[model samples]
Target: MKFVGIFIILILVFSCSSEENSLEQYANHPVKFAKQKIDNPDNDFSIFIPKNWEWKAPYKENGNDILGLFANSKSNKNGFKSIILVKKYKSSQNSKDLKSEFEYLSKQIRNHSQIEEIVDFGSTDIFNQESYFFHTKSKSDTNGDSEILNFLINGNIEGIYYNLTLSTPQTTDFNTDMAVLVQSLKTFEILK
Candidate 1:
């Protein structure tokens, strides 16, 4: 009887955790712009990128913007959440899966903010690559929480990561300042 009680309690705890997670799933993202090129020569794909923002340098190897959206502002200037990253996954990964993985991976960023806002837009194909896109705007501070507006995707190879994070102390019109990174998204086909 004691064992049964413990087991039931454990189940309830796990169930509650799973339910809470599902509720918090991408419910705070804010995507204000999007476009795609499904006519790539090799691999076809679609992506929702930001419109325009401040410009920076390209992503360094093993760094954030692995897809090539030109990234910088790594360590926030004394707790200011500002990070722009882009990269194309090496392996052939489509969009649907990418969207799922992005949520999972965003949690893996070195200084990932605690998601407070999430919004899911409909899914669409980019040329031939299956794409999953969503918007997110965090509402926390650096040490306390963060703020973010993101458009994440998965290119059917490995996995593409495009993210713009706003950490603590963020004061700029982050939305308007992220267009440069957002509009740089380009689609391509995977040659077979």
Candidate 2:
């Protein structure tokens, strides 16, 4: 059973290449709805939210820009998500460094969430750019809603930071879209 769970994590990540973005397995994912919204008043930020979710602004004292997303799987009560945010310091230079930072941050976030790191699949985005994928789960913390997180250098040249999480409402709620939220990311465009 333990090994099988690990296998699932591997499949969720590992899209074959670091520079390829494929929705191949995304649809197989039970994500229902998703959206991209401006999380900050300054308009310097945005994030994708999954369906049947609730959004909460981050506290001022938080070290990094943060937002909360709670998912609602109308059918599966165990279908939910939470997103713990950290900063993404990425531009053009040293792309590898940005990827490393994301990976390290994901590790720290997973530990804070009390979840064990199961899979860390390396990935890339639309333009054939290298990125990272991570999945963490806290089965004992929540009954059905397990935390599935993907920390990566975004698919866009904008270098957006993505932190996708999934869990149940009993444990926590992100209050945002789960499926369409990713789609929202695809539609993201950079501004001068």
Candidate 3:
């Protein structure tokens, strides 16, 4: 009947409009970043941090030489803070290549007691260099109501291997956070 066809057309139109609106929301608002240079003399590199995010350079903790730590000024609705941590490691002669090193590291992470589950793992190219990434869900040390999401990306430059970890409270908008994190990571550069 004519009424049935009209109703179908109206439903299709509104559904399409809603889909377009959702896409437009993301397209209209792009995340911004500011370049943050590392102060470490041994391994020099720069990374783009989210605009207005708190930055701490030359961060060292528990014997780990963290070159930079960037944290969101505001906590998520769950009262968990999101942070990006960068660590530099000297490349060893025994390691074959980035892939091998990444595999070895991934194994270590999988065996870690804090890591509850590895959501995903794969290889990707970053700035024309090979990079590996691991998306993991981990147990939160703070409390039981929240879980932690760890997105670990590893890439190497000449003699230095860089590990970038984006840690955030597991939330419904995690995909959006991950997209922003990847965008910021794309701006990383080794200072000459």
Candidate 4:
């Protein structure tokens, strides 16, 4: 009986040590970022991009304005790409508040056919601004074996509605990727 107790204690100690090591790894792995400035006359702001990620500035295409685009160089085992896209829209006088906008967006997402599940949705303060966020799991168009993770944050800044999206394959580590992306989002600053 004493031998069995010792064996059990040893197992518990090793398990706890491994868990602590995993947490330490994440805590010690600091994410590096590069600052990106938007030179648009209408919308003057800057945001941080994860170092080594590809970045494309705001541009017009097919009469549509794209605020910014970013993508990480790493791809999941299934070749699924991780990307961040920013879109800006002019807010009208009758534009809805952040909470109302989140309600509308949540309704639309719930009605989408490709959306497998809405994992989480809520409104929170980000960068001292009221923001709405949605986390969803969706069907993958490219790979039937894999699903897609979709995260979106929307807020109105200085009469402009900004939508930031982070999409990645479910195969990637969600916690790690979210930590980096959220850190990048926290760096957003309005210069106007």
lDDT of 4 by residue, 44-145 (tens): 556766666766666433233335444454556776666666656543343556555556667788898878876656765555666666666676666333
Candidate 2 lDDT by residue in tens digits, 73-160: 3434554334333233343233345565565665566567556545435563631345465544555534444545454545333444
**Tens digit of lDDT per residue, candidate 1, span 1-192?**
999999999999999765421112322224344432222222332333333333333334563333343333434445453444444444223434565665555455434545555543334443234444444445553433334434454443454543333222234454343433333333232332
How far does residue 68 in candidate 3 sit from its true spot (Å)? 3.8
Better of 2 and 3 by lDDT: 3
Q: Model 3: runs farther than 4 Å from truth?
A: 1-43, 62-66, 91-96, 143-159
Assess the local accuracy of residue 112 in candidate 4 as a C-alpha lDDT between 0 and 100.
89
Query: How are the candidates ranked when ordered by TM-score, highest leading?
Result: 3, 4, 2, 1
lDDT of 4: 0.56
Better of 2 and 3 by TM-score: 3
Ten consecutive residues with minimal summed lDDT in candidate 2?
A: 169-178
What C-alpha lDDT, on a 0 to 100 scale, does residue 128 get in candidate 1? Answer: 36
Worst 10 residues of 3 by lDDT: 20-29
The 10 consecutive residues of candidate 4 with the worst lDDT sum are 19-28
- The local distance difference test score of each candidate is 0.41, 0.44, 0.59, 0.56
RMSD of each: 11.9, 9.8, 5.9, 5.8
- Tell me the lDDT of candidate 1: 0.41
Quantify how close model 3 is to the true structure by its C-alpha RMSD in Å.
5.9
Query: Model 3: per-residue lDDT, tens digit, 94-190?
Result: 4556777677777788898878867667775554466777767676665222233333334444444677776656577654665566666566675
Best by TM-score: 3
